[model samples]
Target chain A: MKKLSFAALAGLLATPSAAFAQEAGGIDQAVNEVFAAVTGPFVNLIFAPLPGTSFPWIVLWLVVAASIFTLYFGFIQFRAFKHAIQLVKGDYSDPKDAGEVSHFQALATALSGTVGLGNIAGVAVAVGIGGPGATFWMILAGLLGMASKFTECTLGVKYRNEYPDGTVSGGPMYYISKGFIERKVPGGKIMAILFSIFCILGALGGGNMFQANQAHAQISGILGDYPGWITGVIFAGVVFAVIVGGIKSIARVTEKVVPFMGVLYVVAALVIIAANYQQIGWAFGQIFEGAFTGLGIAGGFVGALIQGFKRAAFSNEAGVGSAAIAHSAVRTKEPITEGFVSLLEPFIDTVVICTMTALVITISGQLMVDPATGNYLMDGNMIQTVGGTSGVALTSAAFASAFSWFPYVLAIAVVLFAFSTMISWSYYGLKAWTYLFGESKRAELTFKVVFCVFVVIGAAASLGPVIDFSDAAIFAMAVVNIAALYVLMPIVKKELNSYLSRLKSGEIKRFKG
Target chain B: MTTSIVVGLDGDGSGMRALDFAKKLAKGMGTCELILVYVIEWSPYSFQTAEENAVRHKRREEEIEAALERVVTPSVAALKKEGFSARGIVRHGDVADLLNTVAVEEGADQIVVARSSEGGFVKRVFGTATANLVMHATVPVTVVG
Candidate 1:
């Protein structure tokens, strides 16, 4: 059996390029065609362009939910921002809490999951298409997304099932199913099943494949072209080792690597930004102008708004319900405390880190813009580029303009970011898998093996439609998650009010200042 | 007639050496009990995010479990097998401070510790836990190398 399987694998590897030569179209194209044919309709439905515009309703769904959460909680993201910092600092934490991990580890793990290629490549894409004005909308979206993060994470902790072994199982699935029962709402079980299915798909696509694909891109871009299967196998092996050990192992690596990579990326941006201190005011001016007047792009204000909101939603994943799974594992008796801590995830991931990327790209002057018509120029071409010329290449070019050797560093950061993200998403996917298939050892092993296999497929295949389907699956989670949040916001409010009152009354003891 | 001696276990070979010395010393002192203390140095002051803090509880539990399974229980059981009265404890905090506190709380006549070989720059710069224990312990301290 082993010899046969090995022979089959060897044949598969050896034939890919030869097959490409013979077919003229290649395996990537064939796979993409098949994926598009099979999954394109559902992807289109989820990401259908709004009437009279290119923007998807899913973006609007996230934006609307975030805005409602921000208002419904009375702008708790702003009001509790200081306390959120303190909560992360463990000022109100007791070491005796019933959860598996600490608030800081949970936040770090979640941040590692969200703050990957999106912050680096996605920001560049948004700015390239939507212009400098997109930065303003992106920042606004990040601010509002914090409230959404707070709502979902609090529900994650409140409704989580703590097993006898002290491990926790939570997320939108738990909250949607259990929270509905508590509130006497209907069809929670069905919604939870739907959410679980989407979450698993999202974990495989965005969390696993997207990361592996991008990491391969960055690595190959630096090391010169090699078969992507090589990168896929190596990444899959490393990810399997870390993820198989469970959240603890993933957390250990992320806690260290996430901070290091975040600092490295931010400091590089800061150095470049500082070097262009003279252009700082001018950049902000462009951002404000482009945001309002549409920078002469066809979409104008609405276009910038859509790009900004879409990228921010995609980057920080505030309303997508993925981070809630990571945060739900935090050791806290008061579920509200985790909510306070989670609000900082979007702020750190989007507001702070992504904004830095945008500023660096803008200040570097890599993106050629025509002053008269407010259009980006590529060889005197009025480029109506959306996802084109955006991504790691753009970000790398922007950084390379400032520091010649920065592309190398950016490549390293991308790989690390991709790795940490994959590990975190592995846990997220596993939790959803267990939620569907009972939490047995065999079930867990099967899901993990499949997840690792997807890593290889992601790296090996040029799967545009697969990526689109996965991205759609990720946003699909937001649809169901936001619906549940709308129903459960009142419960979060009650927890918030009670926690605040007790906190104000000194009922919540401060363990350390 | 009863006396208690605090033995600080570092969960290493040297810690077993100190435990042997404490057992021998307790045998000389009539009706004495050896209090085996394993200190897991934990600082709550580091700047950490909520995600790091979430795992702190599990880590602390794991640390205690490891100390008991790999350090305290084995040492205590070995001494008890040799016919000495011994009890074990695992704690988290500043190693020296916690050791001193345990000595004072248990009414230990003296504190025994293995002399750590982590000297040179670390010793001159930060000072070893054994040195700090000897200097700050309320009761008399014996360093067994």
Candidate 2:
């Protein structure tokens, strides 16, 4: 089994990745190589041609998306921030809102979509590679991603499709494809179709499979001696049972789980951090220094910054089109309501949660063990695990150093965090599947089955290589999503300005359903 | 083919009301195998797993037994200490579907739950768990106000 995974990884990599890594051997070098294979060349061969060529070009496209939307919608993220709060406070819970969930429900749903392994495992990767510096960039990217989320979710509400049955379906796929068709863009139909295809694939890889795999890994780590496939089969069965029932089940679970787990993990991380109160100053010093000083195992300032940004971008997933699908299902007359609540996701995931992960690891004093200082030999260096394991266990070790009970507590936290995340992603991927493949029971079942299989794959295999590749796919979704949002920025801007006007006029009146 | 009536108990919001009503309904059903369920909202803070983060897969089964004893037994006992044949099931994810799943598992005829809604107008138009369940459930769900 190990041989097959390595071989499959080799075949996947021999195509483009291994050689690229040879050319660039910094900490992120291996990660970048895997990403290179996924973003354009490999995916294009399997599917269709992607729009951009270079990394900078990809960044440019996203900037264009933010700019066009900001100008067109008159900077909705800023204007709507205030009203978004009122909306979150329950100002617009009208059943006539043409969606299956309330605004808070939608925001919680979307948050469940974005806040997952990325925060925990993803942050671990950044800090492991970038040292403490990655936390800074991760926080910055999370804040900016808020605006992108605001723009995309606002678009989700405006362009949402209300079926005669009160079942609503919307996302980047709907807004980009359906909205473009209404506007009559040249080859807009093809663009929309292509975007839908990418979304479904992205959903399968990043949202569904990735979630199951990470959750399985966390569970296996905590329980010990369990069959990976058994976890997969049982998880699939449970997810199948929930998903087969559709969005209501998904909403019910996420609303409760997201808040509870989110608070739980944060408080636990804080507990560990607080115990090391004397080291707090040094921890920040190391993080800021590592950000610019190349203080990690990567051996360069730029490398640490890039890894941090990449992981943060991957973690919070603010710019990606995934959150839009979750937010799109919200029940609100106003699009901005869901968008405002959506802003909290990045703060929770990247700024707060991601920071906690970094601090716990850093404060645990396992990061940069200067054998010279004889302090503890970590130094942001990627220590190779003899057997395949990463993420929560590593965070666990850090906490255990400060608090004896942390190992067990952290393990339990990881499993639940991973479980809730995987279930939520299953919903996102299913929606994407339904969007592109036609809503058939077979399509849904097949996707669910494959997703379950991948969970086992994620658990059994070493996380580093495959997750590196999968992380790229998650970012690739951003490339496509930002492009669509750029073109549809006007719709987002218009929604923003209108909401601001309403807020200024005191029209929102009261808050609560 | 034992006739079973399953009632979902949530400790939060209007769940207390749901449990009380389900107990009354069970009494009326007479021969029904009453099943009481309580979902612990995911909290990093818990007395049971106080120092722990998640309910272990095995422990969840244990939690089902224990919660049945602790929360349900006393509550059920209060209904004139009904000496009815009853069991409990505990699930880990979302409340609405878990209740729906338990209903299907126990072959429940009716599901009773309390409505949790945030906004006033939205609550009326949507009616919380009742509205959501009606849209998605394969069985009739009677939500306690």
Candidate 3:
């Protein structure tokens, strides 16, 4: 049976390129075509426009939910923002009784997970297609999305399964099931199962595939056009080693390195912005004007809003329930504390870091603006730029315009970002996988192997379909997760109220300033 | 005047040398109260994965309980048996900060610690907790080598 399966695998790998050699780009092209076809319906269904409007319903779905959460919680994201900072500062932490993870560490881990290609490539896509107008909407979405993160993450910790050992299992899947049971709502199990399935798909698509695809794109942009499959193979090998081979040292190295890269990327962007200091006011004018009138861009203001919300959702993963999994690891007895801490994730991921990218892109003048129309010139659905590139390429071009050596640094940062994001998402997907298949070693190994395989496929495949599918899968998680949150929000409110009252009453002590 | 002295422990047996030194100082001063402090070196800025984060609180509880059982409680009892007033404190944070905080909280007039044998290249460059405490502590500090 093993030999037969091995032969089948060998045939599967060899036949694609051989059979489709005449097709442009061989196996990569073939795989992309097949994947696009398979994933098209789901993507369309998820992104399908509202009647007589170009705006996708899923973006509206997420935006509306975030707004509702903001209202429902009375803007806890703002009210508790200072306290959240304090928690992360370890001000409220018991020094003698520290948790396995400090609030700061949890926040940092979740930030690292969310702040990657989505900020780099995804923001470039948003600004490229939607113009600078998207940056305005992106910041708004990020602000509102904080409430969504707060709600989902609170539920995550509240409903997490603490085993006999110190380890835990939590996320949308757990909360969908356990929360419903607590609320006496039926179909919790079914919804949880569905959420898990979507989560796994999302992890494979956005978390692994999107990251690998962009990393390869950035590398190939620099190293010259080679088959993405080669890049895929190397990334998959390294990812497999870290996740499967128990090479925690690699994970540790990445954890340390990615943050440094993040700092460097920000610094480089700041340098560009600082160099173009006089254009700062003009950039703001363009953003505000473009946001309202769309500056004659396609879909105008709506187009800008859609792109902003979509990229923000994709970048921050706020309402998508992925941050819930990461935030659940925080060592706080009061689940609301983690919730408060989590609200900062979107603020940092989208509002701060993403805005930095957008500002640099805006200030760089890589995006061509129409002098007569006071609009951005569009070519084939993307802003007509110097090289007509999009995603990380556009970002690279923007940076390279300022400093020729920056792209080399960006390439390294992109790879590190991609690697760290993939590592984080693998864990998220694994939790969801174990939730569905049970926590057996075989079930886990199966999921990890499949995850690694998708890394190669993600790298090899073209960007459009991979991005479409990635967005669809991640938004699908939001659909299920937001529905669950709508029901479970009262619970979060109760936890929040209780925590606040205790703080007021001095029941919750501040251990440090 | 019932002088109080804070003695820092490294959680290992190495702290006994500092305790012995503080005891002699207390004997010379007369009517000195000893506060045994065991600090678990920690910094909030350190990175950890989700799995590591999950087990951290549990591990912390175990470390505190073990320190109390295997070190602090016994030493406190032994000091009391020797006709001296002694209490132990165990905490998780930056060693120097927490020790200084504990000393201030306990109204200690002196702080005493053994020279850390764990000194390496990094420690030498960054300075050890003993060095930090000696440099920054408001009270007198004694480093027993």
Candidate 4:
């Protein structure tokens, strides 16, 4: 599985820049073409249905699915909130434990992985295309997503293994196979192998290439004719230095970078909001108004609940097994302790950051428009199509509108966000790779070498539909991943109950400082 | 050539635990000075304008020092009793940066800090500070659990 992800990432990055050139007039014009081709079809699909039809089936189904997970767990995410606080508090500190890193570092590392261009660029796309209404459902989806994260991270911890040397390894592949293994169920190992394949593909397509490509686009556009291929090569090298060091170093770096980037991005959004403070009332009105009323036609609403749910799922990654791959490495013995802290991820990524971006774009009121195509823009007056879940450029334009330096600041932010994400996901893919191949030092180094090559490839390539198909392999991971979570939800329940009982019994008290 | 391997220590008064660990290494080697680091967490008390309140607020450090005397000073006295040369010194502000600077200044062989408890004000201090030392420090760190 890990090998395939690396292969796909390398393939995406290897595509010739001549393919990207298109003899195009400017970098924006070329990159924008890719954006239109990807997002256009989705916008048409969402708006195509006849008027007065009830919300799309996806909307109903997602809401129901999210609600079931939320209620069945009795909002375990909320109850675990205090435990999450204490998890960092050292109520359960075990430095002698088997893991490669500590609980807090693992959480920060996972955040650095998931909270990327999605929060900055993707949120703007959601509001730009889906309209303000999408924000409503985005929050709703995020609310339920907390439940999804809780379920997956718990499974990740339960199924984790410690090598004789104290290195820790666990994720969906292990949980799916091992959970059923204990039950003496057949096909569990086969299922585990399939999930590993999906994970490796996801990490390469989404975690590495997709990130590198976006980072390339942002930097190259800002710099202009600065030899983009060289820029890409440098990015891969920087990523390599961190990747070769393994999880402890990656964790060490992200624990500092994630909070710095997240807070910085939020502060930028606040500046935009303050610049257009008077228009805030109308922005809120448009959001609630567009969410229900459809902006596609005179009457059609833009995002509806379905678009909101889909985009939110893409943003926070609650159900996906990726974050679980990270939380599993934490040092504590109580799986639930990490699980509690893990829940905070979705809130920060989606509910907080997404909301900030949505408010910023909505307030600016310029309306997203595709200049040449007129596809994403409405009557050429507003956006005809929102960039397919990548809105960094549009958000950049909005920030630049308010402050002269914002575009450059945002460009740097995007690159740093992308860099942190690529390194962390490399760890995730390596674990899955180890599951398929034996865990020899040689095998690990091979994966890292191949992974580094892909970083360069993703940056230089055109990032066409071929890469998009591979990207689907990443999202497709959730289908197999959530299934594994289901069979293993019982173990998750036992762990949570056990941890809670300990907390209440005072067995897990604050270290007598 | 003698390598000046300084045994470095730093924390709040609670850092006595680190001092104990530092003492062991200094005694074992018999060739280094023991530097006890005290990072006085800045508070409103530090700014108390009245002499009494100022003293009371300043007392937090003194109180911490008194506690340190119980934990760290005795080690210094015991080392002197054993006829080995050692000294305990203090510095303040941003525990991680302070530790790093002292490590370089002392040309320390190793740094010893207590494994932070998972709760309270100490969490932020030790968690980030230790992480900083890991990334930026010149010497090896032995975090006593």
Candidate 5:
């Protein structure tokens, strides 16, 4: 009976793509059918259009939450930006502090998860659709998003459950339930459950599958069309090896890979931007002009605003709360210091990395502008669209214009980014899963195996709608997480004020000047 | 006269070599107590968020337990089996600093550690704990290769 059930499960999993692989069209159609059936209504509901406009309410939800946090914290993102850098530098870190990873390692781990294809492909899509003006909004959204990261991460560490074995289980579930109960809020437990459910789903979809899918896309773009399952199997194996060892192994890998890949990508972008130094002014002008004036696109200013805000929110993921999980594992008694360090994440990701990508794409002359209307031409006539562009391909074309060898470098970067993101998500998902199922070896293994399998499915299958649903699931996490954040902000404020006062009084000594 | 000798162990082959040397030295010294300490190189100065920091004590305890169980205890037992007086402890901190601290705290007459194979650029750039202890330790440090 066990064998029969296993075989049946195998067949069920394989039928969608494997059975129809002989006929690519049939497989794509079937995938689309199932995808549309499952994700269509769900996506519509989450990204429901704003009144009399095509802008997604979810995007507005994130924007407003970020704006509110910025105001409530008195723009702490800007005020504490310098201090955040110092925190990351370990200037005030005491060696006797109790923690697993350092603040820098925690930030690196979180940044790896956030700084993947979203910065590359997501930015390209935003720029392609919203024009250069989208970059301005993306930067603005990133700036505002820092405060959200600060609030959520602070609370994450404040209420985390440290096990007897010295391992930590934390994130929105712990914070929402614990923080709310402390404040005598009624729905804390239910909110925690809801957040956990969404977190697990988001981890599998956005964190695992989406990364696998994009890595496969980039590989095929370079290595010719081979089955995605091949990529999937390889990815699953590597991810399993790293994640099975738990956070230490994952942290060690991410701390190295994240920084290396980040620097490599940034240096390359800087080189391209510097080479086009003359056009730097022109690019900034186009960005500013398009940001407010909208380049006469169909949605105009609102459309650009939506795209820019959406990409930035998606890229930095301030209020989404996944970062809190990664940051919570930092070894510090003062949780507020982590909050300060986390604010740097969005800055480095969107403000620095994403901006570099935008500049490269803008200055590469890949985006064609109609001189008469002073608007971008989107009829697929630009050099970036040679192979029918949008997303990572467009970004690749932009870079390749400066260096012919850039496509190969980009392929490597994409794979490393995908690998780092998948492992980090595995931890996030496992924490949420354990929260619901009760933490045990069996439960952890179950989640890890299931996560690895999805990595394969993500690579092999052409389920666009499934990925869309997963993306929506990620935003759904933001909804629940931000609600909890609102209630928990007061606690965060108390911590922040106490920490700042301590700093002023020299109570928090600098171990290193 | 019970002479106390501090021996550092890293749970590696080199550490065992040092342990063997210390055991021989303690035997030659007639009546002696071998204070075996395994120091796990840990930096508390790294920046950590609250969650990782919360479990710091727990992890340190676990590290001490593992070091005692997997490394120090077995060695101490074997030494005792050989009719030598020995005790084991595990700690988390800089190896040289902790070794010196443990030596002084135990009131040991001398300290012994294996010469790490790590040399050349690594030794110059990031000096080994043995070299540091030899220079800075209050007690006499015996470098056993």
Candidate 6:
């Protein structure tokens, strides 16, 4: 779920650029066309809809895996929700513990990685295309996604490689390989390699490109028409400064600033929702009505479901396994604790934050609803907008209608979100790169340079094929990761049960009352 | 009866003054035990990047070791050499809270801290450890300025 905001932005950006590509002439344009042509077959295969259905099979694959995990874990997301909060609150964290950071810090860092543009622009994309009904499916997907996160993160900690120097590394790559070998499953090594390759690509595609692309979009949207490559070059330079220059000051500033931005965005959305208190019920009615009946919208309820689930999955990334890498660094004796901590991620990212964006968009009176049929007026296939905008711009318009200065604030937030996501993903990609090659200074530098270069390419190019390939690369990770989870779930169940029994017997101590 | 007193240290002149004041009070009381403690200010809620978080545990351990060697150990040896019952502990957390916790856990008779002279906007807003300990500690708090 590499900020579905960028993926959706790319999707929307692709439409206008596709219409104008012939009129535009440049090396970058030519490169984008060729890249799209070469990767189109692969992207289509990964995202291809099921037979006789408009839904993408990859979406179905993720939804089904999450559903199965929810059932298999006895809906542990719900059952252990309170326990998860307690863990995050430091109730179970001993000050004398051996881990690097507290559960709260780990949760915060992981939250930073997941809760970005996905909640902002991605929600806009879902509600725009899928209608208000997409909000409902998005909430359901988030609920089910908690279980998928639980399973993968537990295995991540269990199979992590703890170094002698007290550093550790783990993710789908480690667990898939080691868990498979332990269970006597063949092709574990090959599967791990495959997952690593996909992860590196994902880190480049969704993590780097999509972020750079959308950051440029949001900036240009505010600053008037300008070449995207210029924005791309500036962004790439800053990113290179952070990742390559090893500038601790930049990380520290962003570490403080990004969370503030997240809060600012949420507060802005809440204020908008509160101002339109009367339309609250009407908007919800549209969400519920559009969810089941589709309200004369295209593809009916199915369209809403696909858009909702896709956006939710892409936003929170429960089954995606990239989060497992981040969660694995948490210090805990029981791996199940990290798993429990992880379930809160989708809830915070999708259920709470994304819903705020959906409500703001729905209540802002941007999407024209017909007074007679009570259906949304459609422009071509999209919900017709009063501002005649789409993607992140539509969201900005909705918020700006309320605050009048939200676009400026949102632009800053989007850039910060993109930079933070890029930095986090760079670490994730570097881990995969080192796993494939050996861990060395040269290897790390090589990945960083290439990653920054892609950031430029991502911003410079039109988003058509870049978005497609990014979506495919990220989903490809889930394809390998979920398959590994299906096999290794019993181990998690055993861990969960043992931990519960110990808690019941008073063996698992709580540091705080 | 031997009384126990917890003295908070900041590894500076103020800390040594606090130690001196505690020693004088302990000597006056006869056969007192001095528990010297130094806390490296930290909060679990502070935001950190993945790379920062990954190294935090090691950094914390290093911090504790450095505090023990550079501050607590020397203070303990000096006190003990002067015929005082002194032991040192180094930890990572908010100074006031940790001092109170240590005092409560040790069943100390009183807490002693040096009033920090570095007063500024941040310190004034957040409040100094001496002010907080004086207000919140269950045991008696003596601020030696």
Best by TM-score: 6
Model 1 lDDT tens row, A350-450: 99999998998888886677778655654222233322356678888888878889889888888988888887787888888999999888998999998
lDDT of 1 at A314: 91
Off by over 4 Å in 2: A1-82, A92-100, A245-258, A296-299, A369-390, A440-446, A449-472, A511-513, B1-145
TM-score of 6: 0.93
DockQ of 1: 0.24
lDDT of 6 by residue, A1-513 (tens): 334433433443344445434433454455466667778888999999999988999999999999999999999999999999999888998877622587788777778888778888888988888899999999999999999999998998899888766777888999999999888888888989998998898999889888988888888877887767678778888888888897888887987899898888889989988888999999999999999988766888999999999988999999888988888888899999999999999998999989989999999999888999889898777888898888888889999999998889989998898988988888889888988997778998999998887887688676677677877998899999999999999889999999999998999999895
Residue-by-residue lDDT tens digits, candidate 3, A1-513: 334433433344444543433442554444456667777888999989999988888888888999999999999889999999999998998764553588889888888788888888889999998889999999999999999999999998889888775677889899999889999999999999988888898888789988898888888878899877688889999999888897778888888998888888888888999999999999999899989988767888988988998888778887899989988877778999999999999998899899999999999898898899777888877788878878888898899999999889988998998888898889889999999999878998999998998887777656467668776888899899999999899998889889999999999999879
> What DockQ would you assign to candidate 6?
0.53
Off by over 4 Å in 1: A1-26, A95-100, A245-255, A369-389, B1-6, B20-35, B40-66, B74-86, B92-112, B117-144
* Residue-by-residue lDDT tens digits, candidate 5, A190-299: 98899888889888889998899989988998889988888988888877776664445544554566667789889999999999899999999989988999876547
lDDT of 2 by residue, A1-513 (tens): 435443453443233434433432342344444445545454443323235421233434444454554555455556556666666655554422211244555655556656666677777777776677778776766666677777777787677666653456677777877777666665555655666665655655565556666666667666776544466557666655555544445435544655777787788889878888999998988778777776534546765766676666667777777777777765566776777777766666777888888898888766645656423234335633212235666676676676777666655555556656666666666666777787777987877766665565454334444454455555566776776776776665566667767867978555344
- Give the clashing pairs for model 3: A99-B56, A99-B57, A100-B56, A100-B57
Clashes of each: 21, 19, 4, 22, 15, 0
Ranked by TM-score from best down, the candidates are 6, 3, 1, 5, 4, 2
Q: After superposing candidate 4 on the true structure, give the runs of residues whose Cα lies further than 4 Å from its correct spot.
A: A1-65, A89-100, A245-255, A295-302, A368-377, A380-390, B1-145
User: Can you tell me which runs of candidate 6 are displaced by over 4 Å?
Assistant: A1-25, A227-230
Task: Compare the candidates by lDDT and give the number of the best one.
Answer: 6
Candidate 4's residue-wise lDDT over B1-145, tens digit each? Answer: 2233333344354366666676677667756666655553332112111111212323445655764676457766776787656666554345666676677877777788776545777666656566666777777887776
- How far residue A472's Cα lies from its native spot in candidate 1, in Å, is 0.3
TM-score pick, better of 4 and 6: 6
Report, to 2 decimal places, the DockQ of model 3: 0.49
List, for all models, the DockQ compared with the true complex: 0.24, 0.03, 0.49, 0.04, 0.23, 0.53
Superposed by TM-score, candidate 2 places the C-alpha of residue A421 at a distance from the truth, in angstroms, of 2.5
Model 6 - which docking category?
Answer: medium
Give me the displacement of residue A305 in model 3, in angstroms: 1.8
